[model samples]
Target: MTPLISPRARPLAAALLCGALAFGALATSAQAAFNPPIRMSHGIEYMSGGIGSDEAKLMETVLPRWPASFEFAIKDHQGADFAADVHVTVRDGRGVALLDNVVAGGPFMVARLEPGSYQVEATLRGQTLKQPLQVVFGTPTKATFLWPAGTDMAAAGTRAVQ
Candidate 1:
């Protein structure tokens, strides 16, 4: 019996299959790294959301099931979600950094930190809002970091005004 593929085409086909498999592996890993639950040091796990209407809707659905912990919501003084170009840093009372990362595409970030005092610093639109909060066991702690009113999202690289 003769092989269906010509000998000359075997290497090319093999290479394409390997490339596709490699790409699929990388995509799966990257997706796992970002979505559903983001883990941090000291037993802190977080979820990011509200970057779009669809995602916001999904978040609302899961809002009730969110772990009882510290919740950080970013918005502007005008009550608009500050969901663009954001940086978040959470430090414990002893100044130990617990969470330090950029908010890729969300207005809300939830972290289950150990019950204690923490400082949450959120930066957006070239402005920073630092908040002091405490998390208690069995109680939900929420903190909203707000940007100054009339803050220019475009100027902060948060959005491009057309």
Candidate 2:
């Protein structure tokens, strides 16, 4: 028996199939782009991201599993969260740098580090703030930095980093 389908319809069907496959590949890649990287520190696994609601949600879900976490925020003396471009550095007890040259995209950052003494330094507009933190077992610690209100952050030339 001869097939009843026409040649013209076969080419149309093949084109449609190719288009669908291409769409699927693109969709998968797009979703993967949103996935952030998880880094392991001194036997502790952590991820950092609080730039937007989507990343915030991801950090919220991951917080419970990690024993220690660090958050960065630029707030005025009144304690209002404000956006600012700041450079962050973390050092261990021996003055060895744990993490350096990290730029926060937004006011908040979450990270996990081993339970120990750490020194956190944030630089903004030529002013530096230093804070000492200790991470204990089973207790999730948070550190917040508040920038003075009277100063003008805009003149500092703030920029967001990924």
Candidate 3:
């Protein structure tokens, strides 16, 4: 019959409950964001992943720390969709391959490279896109490779025809 919480303390209790709920939400999101593990190849370190919304958010958060970042997508009438299983190759100015691998985890990748001129080649559905890039100190070199639509590699089960 009697109120358990005094009128003077009701606002404080409500505020505490709200704060606790907010903190719980924040903890859940922090746990949801999956930060891909950093890998090393030939002394260069890199990480690749952006498969889900939370992972993508985590990727964006660390974009500024890497010297080079690459994003993969496929263009369509509605815009583009993130792509995976892209074969990416990074070459130095002398045409020596530094990082040659396939992105099987996700579509976004960040790499630590010395500031210099480089060549990036990304292949999807047997179609390759090449771009020249210059990585500089104190700046992150960003590149996005977008393939044309209709090249649904998985659905086609073979190389996409021109």
Instruction: Give a tens-digit lDDT track for model 2, residues 1-162.
Output: 765767779889889889999999888884565445666544444456555566665665666666555554445544544444566778889998776747655444556777899898877666678999898887877776666654435623232322
lDDT of 2 at 141: 76
Per-prediction TM-score to the true structure, in the order listed: 0.60, 0.59, 0.74
lDDT score, residue 75, model 2? 51
Q: Per-residue lDDT of 1-162 in model 3, one digit per residue for the tens?
A: 889999999999999999999999998777656867888777889898877677777888888899999987777776667777778889999998888764536678899999999999998878999999899999999999888887653521122111
Per-residue CA lDDT of model 1 for 1-162, tens digit only, reads 999889999999999999999999998985554345565555567776555555555555555454332233334534453455567788889898777754635655677766788888877666778889787776667776656555544432232111
lDDT of each: 0.62, 0.63, 0.80
The Cα error of candidate 3 at residue 116, in Å, is 0.1
Off by over 4 Å in 2: 1-34, 39-46, 77-79, 82-84, 150-162
| Clashing residue pairs for model 1 | none
Which candidate number has the best lDDT? 3
Off by over 4 Å in 1: 1-43, 63-81, 155-162
TM-score of 2: 0.59
Model 2's number of clashes is 0
